[model samples]
Target: MKTISKWLALVVTVFLVLAGCSGGGDSADSGKGENGKVQISFINGFTGGDGAYMKKITDAFNASQDKYEVVELQEKDHYTKFKSGEYDLVVIHGNNLETYKQDGLIQDMSSVLEKAGIAETDFHQAGIDTVKLDDTMYAVPLDIHPLTMFYNKEFVQEAPKTYEDLVKINDELQAQSKDLYALGVPSSGLVEFYMLMIAAQNGIDLEKDGYLNFAQPEYAEALMQFHDMVWKDKVSPAGLGLDGEFQTFMKEAQEGKAYQTAVALTGPWFYGGAKEKYGDNLGVAPIPQIGSQLAAYGNSHTIALPANVKDEEKLAGIAEYLKFMYTPENLINWADGGQAPVHLPTLEKVTAEQEKYQIAYQNSQQFDDYVSAPQVYQFGEQIRYMNESVFSKVVTTEKLTTDALMKELEKATEMAKQIAATAPQQ
Candidate 1:
């Protein structure tokens, strides 16, 4: 009886030990908020070369402090991981923020910022406005990525002040030689092409009355003119889609086959690539304007906290790291992506490297022509749909009809309205 009891005790003890091991207590908790170490996952959709620039900033931030650590998760997969409640903070583009906010994946940082004593004015007005909805701030913007025309100083020496001037130059270039197209428009660059053109041509305010009103006649006219420039005038490449449009133009520019692109609708990374590939031949200008309004299509990369992160000290630490990221000292490093800084005060005090990126940014006559906020979300898509139809027909040399295109625009706007209705608003 004693031996049997001893064997049963041994079995029970072994079972308990196995259960403890399976419970994962010994394994390190990736998110253990203990011992003054706060782990934050920084998420972004930046899978491009720009990711390298942001990584540089994040790495420095992590090393700068023992209290907080920022681990950047690259691409859409980052969000997938973040959604599993594995992250504390988010640093993503504005496009995905609204949905994230609605899904309760991200927390409202307004109260958090207030408690932390960070003034809203400490950041750029545009940046602040970009992340706020219905008087509640959700994300904090890092930079305003707007469209600028990067031109070749060799062929187009004089900056065209008006759309007429730009069109006239295109006419001259096209009339001279077929191989030397005056401008190239990306086929897949539907959203960017429409927004920049609308901003330059009519100065459409993307945000109005909590919804997008893109069916206005002025917007339609801009779309028609853009279509005319590409298809009717043969200025842009034919049979091109979004993927090939920029590459075709860049290749042509490098080979001296083209003079200038219709406009290079890209973020700051383009400037660095141009400097490396085509040195001194590049010039940047804010998208040109045809009217009194001079708004450009811009988007923001923002910072936010996950809905479940409840630590006050961790939130404070994250804000401090963000303050560091936005400061002039760190912004210069952030500018390695070749984008202009969001903080206007630091715009003038840049390093030599930043100046190289700023040359084109500073020359833009309509640098203030930026429309990078929540309103752009729906209207941007509608404009892209309209532009793609008109531009594609133009590129293929199809007959330009106002009626057919108008129908498409109406459908797109209606679709956008449906989407907006279902869209998460917070």
Candidate 2:
């Protein structure tokens, strides 16, 4: 009896030791906060005014929940900081979805969204499509920032809805004020986005064989059309780089200066400043069709989880936060950042209240036609920084011809091929 009792005691002691070891090990609970909520470190590049707006949403989400505490950082260069993998969630541009996914930085979000009770059909089709790569969903979209047309309502009675309408508006503006430019065309900055719009409308296939199809005839035609906006029509002044066009548009008509730029093609980033300058005279409209088909330069801001954040509790918290932010009523406030929330229901709410969100409401309608960029690794680095874009050359080159422009495109095409080659196929 004594021998049996001693064996039982030994077995019980061993079992307790095993239990203690399992209890002390690292796990999803390690990230829990003092309040017993999982702490989700979220990061993004929404600096300046955009940061402030996103913070409000984050704060509201924190206030509305108890299971998760999201601590967010806005670095403007957040991508660099995110490389440390300390963050669980990050906001990225729709076009960069493929780059992040291919690099194994972000995870496929289809299952995540499913667990969160969010459906692909719950979001706008364009927004969903923007973040999808090769049929795999990557992130939940937050907002679409399309290039909107800003005009002076004081000078123009109504916003132009088509190419002919723009020409007529420009002619009328010229007649009324000979010194003012009818339109402003940025020679830099937005050149890439502008090309996307032009490329799509001209039926230029965006990507083929993992490279840009700039070597096509339709692309040349697109360049010619863009050149004509400044040279042939003489509606826009030549060589108005990004700053020149925006500054001219925001110039005061007061102080004995005639309105220099009656119309401008810019993004939501400039709307607040323009409104402050123009007051009620600021008019927002879709960047009317420059080609036979409607295509806008735009992309969505999406929320994604980093691949390293696999804690089940933390994932649940992230899902809660995503669903909360994506809620129609919750996301409607995103318009404060001069962007359209990609949640279709939220956009409908904004469009219904146009007086409060004119630019966002109008631009929201244009997202459906936005030229979605194809997968090209570090697309901005590969294409956006190139000094010799077809648009810039067309607008600035003196006595430029199609043949000469084709040669320029050839150089850019080769450079693009080299860049695309570096992108690994997933």
Best by lDDT: 2
Tens digits of per-residue lDDT for model 1, 1-426: 999999999999999998988863211135544545666666676777678878888888888888877767776576666666456667766665666776677778877676555567766676777778657788776777765566666667876656676778677766655555655665555445444546454666544454455556665566666566566766665555674444554665434444435345444446666666567766666656645555666556787878877766667767777776766667666565655566554454542444455642442223355555444334445445545554565345457566766666567667666666665552
Off by over 4 Å in 1: 1-30, 33-36, 114-117, 205-213, 243-245, 253-267, 290-292, 351-354, 359-367, 373-397, 424-426
The residue ranges of model 2 lying beyond 4 angstroms of the native Cα positions read 1-30, 252-259, 385-390
Candidate 2 lDDT, 99-149, residue by residue in tens: 888788988888779888888887778888788887888888888887778
Sequence-dependent TM-score of model 1: 0.80
Point out the worst 10-residue segment of candidate 2 by lDDT: 21-30
| TM-score of every prediction relative to native | 0.80, 0.88
